[model samples]
Target chain A: MWRRRQDPDRAAPEAALGAILAAVLAILALIGPAPAWAAETAAAKEPAGAAPAEPMHVIVGYLGQEEVPRQPLSFLEPELQDEGVQGARLGIADTNTTGRFLNQRFDLVEAVIPRNTDPAVAIAAQMQALADKGVRLLVADLPAERLVQALDQPAAGGMLVLNARAPDDNLRNEACRPNLLHTIPSRRMLADALAQYLVWKRWTRWMLVAGRYPEDLAYAEALRRAARKFGAKIVEQKSWTFEEGNRRADSGHTTVQSLVPTMTQGADHDVLVVADERDIFGEYLPFRTAEPRLVAGTQGLVPTNWSRVHEQWGATQLHSRFEKLAGRWMTPRDHAAWVAVRAVGEAATRTRSADPEQLSRFITGPDFTLAAFKGQALSFRPWDGQLRQPVLLAGPRMLVSVSPQDGFLHRVTTLDTLGDDQSDSRCTRQ
Target chain B: MGRMRAGLAVALGVLTILPGGGAAAYSVYVSNERSNTVAVVDPETLTVSKTIPVGRRPRGITFSHDYKHLYVCVGDDDRVDVIDTASGTVVDSLPSGPDPELFVLHPQKPVLYIANEDDNMVTVVDTQTRRVLGEIQVGVEPEGMGISPDGTVLVNTSETTNMAHFIDTTSLQITDNVLVDSRPRVAQFTPDGRHVWVSSEIGGTVSVIDMQTRQVVHKIGFEVRGVPKEAIQAVGIELTADGSTAFVALGPSNRVAEVDQKTYAVRRYHLVGQRVWNLALSPDGKRLYTTNGVSNDVSVIDVAAGKVIKSLPVGDSPWGVAVKP
Candidate 1:
C-alpha cells in the first residue's frame, strides 16, 4: 500500500550527503507506511482470478531487443549481457507482485526469438501464440521502430506492450502510440537531469568533448539541446577520435584540457563534460586531466542507468534483495524491466483484470502512477510514450549528483520539463 | 554545538540502555544492512528520535540481562558492538564468529549466542567481559540462533542445510541435529520449554520440535505459497509468550502471517513491506515490529488485531528490528 506520491514538491537534499539521506528517508516512507487507500484500492479492484495457484503459473515473452551486438566482437564482459536478456527474466517474479504485494500468481513460460531474428515477424508470431495461451501483458524490450512494427500487426493481437528499452526522446513524442507504456526515459530527460545538477552547482559554463562514434555523437547532440534548453552555456566544443587501445598523451585527455583554455580562459565557469558512449576513452578523462575538474559523462561525472554499488538511498537493500533473488547485482535496464512488471501489477490492481483494454486504461489513465525504484513516482508521457524519470547521475565510485537538481523548481522541475511531459506531447495517447 | 550533540547522544543512550531507570516509554531500533548506523525511534510517541552511528553493516540486536548494555550484530565487522546503557556509547565489542547475525541472550547467564550467517556456525560469547566463549559448527548459512530459558540448550537454524541444530550449552557441542525445512532461520524455544519453533523462510513453513522427543513433531504451513511458493520468500519469525501463536515475515510477498501455535496453522496474513528480515515483540506481547530491509521501515503490527497498524521509518536498508530496554 506504500505508494510514491506524485507531488512535484519532493526534491533532493541540499548537497550530495543531504541528497543520499533524504532519498533514503523518502524511499523508506514510500515502502514503509502504505496508506490504507492503496490496499483498499488493490482489494477493491484486482480480479480474484489473479491470485496464486498451487503450481504457480507465469507466461513471459521476449521482444528480441538487442541491436544485434553489431560487430559480434563485443566484450564478453558482465555489464553488457547484464543489461539485456538476463535482466529481463526478473519480470517473471516481478510480474506476480508490485512493490512487494503478491495478489497475483505467475506461471512463466518464455517465447524467445534468437539474436539476428526479425523482431517484427518473430515477435508477432510469439505474441499471437502467447495471447492464445492467456498471456495478456508483453514485456517488449525492443527498439522504438521494431516495437511499433510489432504492435501494428493484427497477427500480434491486442496485447498491451510494456516498453523496456529504446531511450530515444522521439519515441515518447511524435512516435507515441496507444497501448505502449515505456519504462525507458528519453535522452532529453536524462540530459536535462544532468544539466539541472550542473546549474544547481553553479557550474554554468561547460566544455563539451564529443566522441567519434555515431551513438556517442547523438548523445552529445542531446547534451547540446539540454545545455541550450537550460540557462547554462557550452563555452567550448571539441571532438576526440579513438584509436582502439591507444592511450596517447594527445588522446582525449589533452583534447579536453585544450578546450579548458578557451572555455574558462580568464572566465569563471565550472564542469568539463564528455560524451563518450563507446566506452573507449571516456574512462580515462577524470583525474588524468590537468585541472581539478568535475568531469561528467562517460568519464568523471557520468550518468548511468543504475550502479550495483549505489546503496546510499536504501539502494543497497534493493541490490541485495535482487541479488538474493536473481543471484546477481541489478543492472540499468533491469530497472526498466522491473518498472514494466510493476506497472503491469499496478494496472492489474486497479482494473482487476489482465484483459488488455482494462489494464492499458488503468495504466494510461491520468490518475495512474507507478513507483520506478529510483525513489520517485513514474508515469508515462502521452506523446512519444516514453517513461518520464530522473536519471541517476553517477561517478565511477560515488554518486556525483542526481539530475533534476534543486532550484530549477517548476511544478515538476526542469528535469520533467525537458522530456515530453503532459504539456508538450504531440500524440496525446495518455 | 558538538558538545550538545554528544550530550544528546549520551542521554539517548541512557534512555535506550537503562532498564526501567530511563523512562516509562517504548522505542524501536533497526539495523540497516547497508548503512553504518542504527535507526532509533520512540514507537509509542511515533517519532524518529535519532539515528546513532554504529559499526559497519549491523544486522541483529539484543539487550543485556539487566538492560545495562545493548548488543548489535555487526556482520561485516565480525564483532558484536556493546552499547553501554549509561553512556550510550559503544563501550566494547564481543568477538562473534564470522558474519554474525540474529542473537539470543540468556536472561541470567552472561552468555550470548549468535548465528553466523556466512561461516555456517554459532558463536557463543561471554557478555560480561565481551569475549568469545567458543564456536560451534551447525549447518550451512546459519541465520537464527536462540537459547532456552534454562540456558542449557541453544538452537541454530541453517538456511541451506534445511535443519534445526540443537546444541548443548554446557558442553558447547551440537548434541542433536534434526532436519526441518529449506532455509530454516529464526529458531526459538517455547516459553514453558515444551517445544521449539523454527521458521523456514524460503520453505514458507514453521517446524515444531518437541523438546522431549527431539523431533519435528508438527509442521505449520502457510496457504499463500507457503515455503514452496515461488513468490513468497519468508524470513523473520517470532512467538508469543503464551506459546499459542507465532508470526512469520515474508520478503517479496510483503506480508506477516499469524499462526495458531496449537494447530500449527496460519490464522491470518497481514500485508507489510518488502525484504523484511528480523522480528521483535514487546515483553507484554501486544505489539510486534519487523525490519523491512528493502522498504526501509519497521512494520508495527497490532498483534491482537492481526494487522499492521503503522510502519516506523528507519535508516537506509533497515534489516534488523529490536525493542529498546
Candidate 2:
C-alpha cells in the first residue's frame, strides 16, 4: 500500500504554522483595518535585530509499484524490505541533516500503484495529485514504458523526474525527455564496465550464455557491443533453454549439477559470461561450469552500481549507515534511489532554489557536482541526462576494481567511456 | 683493527653532525592508511628513514604546538594517538570522539579541535591534559579541519553536508556556515589568514573563502589536457610562506597543480604518483611532498622548478603527510 505520508511527525510543525497564519489572517480581516494588535503581531514576528528564519520546502515524490512477494531462487538472497523506498527515505533523512543548517526541509511523498491496476492511468492521476500539491520533483522507480507515460502526462510537464530503477537504454536515447534524468546505470554501461575489467585482466576471450528472455538478450547484445569496443572476443554464444527448477525441491541440486555442466561443455574461453537478467539459472552456472574459467556478467564477478562489500573511498560509512537504517544490505536499486534524491538535494542546496526549472538547470549545468560516494564527482550529461559515474567491479566478498579503467579514456571524462557518449547519443532533448 | 675503529668513529661523528645541520635534516612523516604505520622520510635523500607502528587506520597527522609530539588520527580506534617525536612511539592517546579523520591545533592555545566523521561533531580537547573539553555540533561527516592564524575561528568541512562550519573559539559555537562544493576534504588558511582555501575533492575546484565576509571570493578550477574532468579531483592544498604560489593535489589524476596565488591561475602541473591525496611542504619551502595513496609512495616536488624530483616508496596507502622542522 502507498504510505502517503512517510513521516507525519515532520509535517506537524508546518501544518501548525499554516494554521497560525490562517488564524492571523482571519483576525486581520475581522479587524478590517491596520489595528494596533495586527501591527504588534507583525513586529513580534520579526525579531529585534535578527531576521526571521524561513525554511525552504522541497517536496520530492516517489512513484513505484506495490511490493509483490518474490520467490528467490536461492535462500541466501532474501526479499528486500523496502527496496527503493527505503533508500529514498534514507536520502531524505541525509538531506534533512544538511538542510537543518541550510534553512531547508526535504520531504518525500510515496505513491505505490497496485499490481492489478493499469500503471499508465494510475501514474497520470498520481502525477496530477502531486502537481496539485506543488510537488515538482519525483523519483520514478517504474519501468521504462510506465515512466514514459508518467512523463507524458500534462500534470508532469513542469516536473523533473529522476529515473532510479529502469536501466533501459532506449529511455536515454530515442525516448529521452528533457525533464527526465536517469540515475540508474544502463545495460551498456554495466556491460562495458565488465568488459573493460576483463580486458585489463587480459581475459579477452568470453563464452556468452544468454537466457530466453528479451531482457537477457538485450544484455547479451550490450555485452557484444562492449566486447567489440574493448577488443574482447566472444568465442561462442548459446541460449539457455532449461527450465528453472525450485531451489527448495529435493531433486533441484541434481538437475542443476548435470544441466550446468552440459550447458557450459563447449566453452573453452577465458571467462564464461552469462546474461540472465530474469535470474532464471545464472546462479547455478557459477561453480558448475565445464572449465575452470571465471564467471562474470550479471552474476559471479559482477559490475554493479553498489555492493555490500565495497568499503573503499569512504563507502564503509555509507554501508554501515544503510545497514543500520534498512537492517539489510543495500542493493543496487537502493543506491540508485539514494543518488536520485541526493541529486535534488544537491541542486537545491547549490542553487538555493526550490523551483523545478532552476533546479533542473543547475543539475545539468557544469557547476553542479554530486558527491555520491563513488570516489568521484558525478554529473549528468546534458545530451541524455544520464548521470556519469564510475562503475564498481565487485565479487561476492570484495571489490575487484572500478571501471572506466586506467587506459580507457574519454575526451570529456573517463565516466563517459562506460555508457553511450555524447557523439553516440541519439537523444534529441534540448 | 685500528683502521676499522677509525671508520666507525667517523660514521658516529657524521650522524651527530647531521642532526644539528639546518633544514636538510628535517623529517617528513606520512600516515599509511591501510598499513597502520607512519613512515618517517628524509627529505634530502627522499627515502624512508624509519617506520613507526601506529593505531588502526591512521589518516590525518599533525605536530603538537611545541613540536614535541605528533598527533595521529586513528579513525577506527576513535582516538588520537600521540607519538613522542624523540622516540617515534605512541606515548599516549586522546579520547577524540568517534571516527576522527582530521584535526587542527590552535596556534597559540593548547586546544585541539578534532573532526569526528561518524558523530557529526567537533571534539575539542586540551592538548596538555589530553582531556575532552567540549564537543560542538557540526554538519554531517566532517572530514577537514582548519584554524585561523590568530586562533579565533575554527573551520570544519563536512563531506556529505557540503558546508564549512565556522566556530568561534571562545564560545565554541558555530558563528557561520558556508556551503561549498561536494565532498570538501581539506581546508588550509594562508599564512596571513585573510582567506581560507578549501579543496572540494569531488567538486574538482578550490573555494577561497574570505575570512571577513565569510563568502567564497574565488573558485579555482583545473583543466589538464588529455585528462578527464572528473578525474581532476582537487584534494589537498598548501601555500608557500610568501603566499606567492599554491600547490594542489589532484586525486586520481596523478598530478599536482601549481597555481599562482596572486593571479589564481594554474601555472603548471607536476606529474606525481597515482591517487595523490595530501601534500606537505618542507621546512625550507623548497621541497613539496605528496602522499600517493595507490602507488604507496611519496613524490618530492621541487618548488622552484615545479617538478617531481623523486618518488620514494613508503608504506601501504600513504594518506596524510606532515613535516617536522
Q: Pick the candidate with the highest lDDT.
A: 2
Candidate 2 to native Cα RMSD, angstroms: 11.1
Error of 2 at A344 (Å): 1.0
- lDDT tens per residue, model 1, B39-132: 7766545556777677888878877877777889997788898877556678888888877778888757888888877565788888777678
**What is the CA-based DockQ of model 2?**
0.21
lDDT by residue (B49-137, candidate 2, tens digit) is 78999899999999987789999999999999999998989999989999989999999988889999887899999988878999998
Which pairs of residues collide in candidate 2?
Answer: none
TM-score of chain A of each: 0.74, 0.87
How does the DockQ of candidate 1 come out? 0.05
Best candidate, DockQ-wise?
A: 2
> Judged by lDDT against the true structure, how good is candidate 1?
0.63
lDDT string, candidate 2, A1-430, tens digits: 0011223222111011011122222312322222232122112111112554778888998988775655556688887647888888889988988887767889998887777887777777888888888777889988777888888899777677899998888998998877788899999899999998898899999999999987898899999999988889999998998766656787678878887788787756999999987676778888898887889988889888999878877887777778888998888888999999999998777766566656665565555568888988787777788888889999978899998786665434568788888777898774
lDDT of 2: 0.81
Instruction: State each candidate's clash count.
Output: 19, 0
Candidate 1 on A83-122: residue-level lDDT in tens?
Answer: 5455565555544433112234554445655567765667
